[model samples]
Each structure stands twice: as structure tokens, then as C-alpha cells.
Target: MNESIAIAWPTDDELRAVGETKVLFGHQSVGADILDGVARVYAGASVAAPVIADVSSGEDAPDGTLMHACLGVNGEPLSKFAAFAEMLDTPVAEGVDVALMKLCYVDITASTDVQAVFDAYTSMMADLEAAHPDVRFLYTTVPLTADRGWKSKVRALLGGDDRMGPADNVARERYNTMVREKYAASGRLVDIAAVESAGTDERSQDGHTYHVLNQSLTLDRGHLNEAGSEAVAAELLKTVATYSPVA
Candidate 1:
């Protein structure tokens, strides 16, 4: 939340000069307000949502600005990334300048080899950068969470998610560390993990990563509460303004 010390944010004049940059934010429930937050933090100079109907993520692509159709018209997430990608192939997103592919909860709790996962992620980013040479492809960090206790089991019943426990937290940290060190590690990436900590949770070795405080998360043990969401939103604006700008 401290913008002054943030390593790479753009000057207000530069951000304003860039005008309204269209950004496609591929995310889950926690990211719902990110665009709106960008509007609030940047005020008149904002990162606007892209034209979704024209994007093409996959073969079953919809015809129009269908990115908004991923969840139907009801605001639910339907195969989120797949749909987002599918729509990007369409014509509506031709002018999109930036894309944030939000990693899923499964990536954090799947209990997989962190290195292998990060390697695959790096490859994916490379591919994206190759495919969309003009658009800025930013790597995003997943938020840290406390042990969900019985809530983990509840998530399993609803769908499938690994329990948010010591081992899972370790994996999450490992992945995030790789993201920071291997990726730009600066303003080019959206450091969701670095910003959500409220100084109330346990810290990682670097001191920037912290588990989500109970106050910052809903009972699900992973999703961001209003305060957490707002904090993240502010950081996201800084990240975009600092790195992905109008050319």
C-alpha cells in the first residue's frame, strides 16, 4: 500500500499521458474489483477493461465480445482462463494493451513440485509473450492464506482444493519466490502476495510475503475480504501504471 517506496510506478504525468489503457484481467472472485480499484486509485487516468467479446482463448470460441460471456451474464466464473483466452482470439480485443492471467487456487494447493510448476509457468508466459508481442503479459502472484481448517474440507465438497496448511503454504511461498526472482521481480508483475499482508500475519523469509489475516479474508480461508481486496486493488494500479503503459 505504500506507493512511494514501490520500486517502479510511473510518474503521474506519464500515466496521464498514456491515457486509458485497456487491460484484460483473467482472475477469480477475489479479482472482481481490480479494474474498479484502478479507476479509483488513478482517478481520471485509468486502466480500462478490454473488449472481451472479440477475444479467442480456445476452439469453442464465441463470436462476439464474448469475454463477458465466460460466466454467462450472471457474473459467475465459468472455466475462467479457458474462456478468457478463447475470447482473446476474437476481434474485440485487438486493441488490448495488457493482460493479467491470474493463477488459480489449485496452483497453490495442488501439492505439486513447486519448481516444475514454476518452470511450466515460465514456459506459458514465454508462449504468451511470443503470441501477443504487442501486449504486456504480466505474471501475477497468488495470495497466501492461513489454514482453512474444516473449510478446506468444505471446498473439497464444493469442488476440489488442497487444504491450506503448513505444507501448502510452503509450496505457495516457493512458487511466489520463483515468480519474483525469475520474472521481472519489479513493477512489471502484479505482486498480489506482497500487498495483501496486514502486518498481522506470519511473514516469510523476505518479510514481504505474509499469510492473509482473518480480517482480510472471508471464512473460505483463501478469498480476500473487503479490506484485503482494496489493498490489493491499490497495489495493482501501481503495478500497471509502473510497467504496462501506453506506447
Candidate 2:
């Protein structure tokens, strides 16, 4: 990563004028690689964009060009939409030209009300648009857990019956479906459910489990390793490229 990446906050006027082509990223534990890949590609293209990592491990440095908020492990954007409005209100520097905004990992299956989650997300985006009109919102889907055993363990830890139970699968499907439908309803929302679903299926077919992190990918069962992240990044890049102004 280059140390000279640019950073500026969009003005109220500028935010309102932002087009549909900017790149913003909202990510989770394993999805950082996807954001990194997007940054690499955009840098290669000489596109002046910013990648904001909402969750931080504190290992990242502020290059002054790109803004890195090291909000720590517990600082992830809340699962509820209303909380997101408060999250976005946290101040970044002025003149930050954000062309795209991504909200990753709003796992509807994990929430009590899938529709309410979707509605809250929609409302949050609407609030962002009102605050920063220049930035577009891209919502990514929750990836499938490749490790059934690990998932079962997690479920057990949470007092769930079984990770592969019919109810659990149904919830997952319903959440993904709602995400697809919501994205389809608005131009501002970009759906990456197909990509995630396909990637998980491919990995399963190949009998590969675990997520990629750093240079060494792991199969710990919760998040993706670096390899898995890169795969996801590639998929998201392909999606973003479709709307990329430079492309």
C-alpha cells in the first residue's frame, strides 16, 4: 500500500453533487482483503478514491492520502440501521471525496427482524445521502460459512440447536433474498449476494473451508483468510467496475 493516498471530506455541497461512480467500502473481519484488492485496482487505474475501513485492528497507519479509522475490534458499525446513522456522524477530515460507501455484513439472518433490518439500512442510506449526497451506497451480502462443524460449534456456543438446521438455513436464505430484493429496488444499493453465494458454493465443491487472512489463510471457521478475501475482492471489483467511471 502506498503511503501517499489522498484524503478529503466531501463538503455539504460537494457531497450532494457526488456522482454514482465513487468507491466507498464498509467491511467486516474477512472482507478487508476485498477492500484492499479494490484499492489496488483503483490505484492501478490512477483513480483518486478513498477506502474507509470502519473496523480497525490498529495496525493501519493514516497515509494522509487515504483515511484509516482504527476504531478497534468493538468499533464495528452496529447491526441496527439507526445505530449506523450515529456511526456515520463520527467526524472524518473535511474534503474527503467519497464516491462510494459500502455497508458490509448486515447479516439479516442474525437479526430478529429481517425486514426491519432492511428498512433500517435503507433509512440509514437515506440519511447519508442527505448528509453526503455525492457518495453512493453499496451493500454487500453475508458470505456462507464454509465450516459446518465450526458453525455448529458457534451455534452451540450461542445455544443454537444445530448450525445446519432447517430453521437456520431458512433464515439465511430469507435474509439473502431480502437483500437481493432491496438492492434491486434501488440504484444506490449494489447486491453482491450472487457473488458470495457462488464463491461459497465453489469453495464447498472444492472441499475448501476457512477464510483467508494476511498471507496465510486459515480455516478457523469465523472469517475468511487472505485468499478467500482476495477472491471476494475480485468479485466485488468486477461488480464495481460495471459502474466505475474510469472503467
TM-score of each: 0.66, 0.57
Q: Tell me the alpha-carbon RMSD of every candidate.
A: 6.9, 9.8
Model 2 over residues 1-247: C-alpha lDDT tens digits?
Answer: 1011122222222222222333334444545555565454444443454434343232332322333332223223344344344445544423333323333332433333656655665676667779875444456554444335565767777887433333333444566666667675655344443433432322222232222111122244334454444455555544444444433
Local distance difference test, each candidate = 0.54, 0.43
lDDT minimum window of 10 residues, candidate 1: 63-72
- How far residue 191's Cα lies from its native spot in candidate 1, in Å, is 0.7
The TM-score of predicted model 1 comes to 0.66
Segments in model 2 whose C-alpha atoms lie over 4 Å from true places: 1-23, 36-84, 90-107, 150-166, 185-190, 199-218, 241-247
> Could you give candidate 1's per-residue lDDT for residues 16-85 as a string of tens digits?
4334556566665555644444444455334433233322343232321113222222122234444555
How accurate locally is residue 68 in candidate 1, as Cα lDDT from 0 to 100? Answer: 21
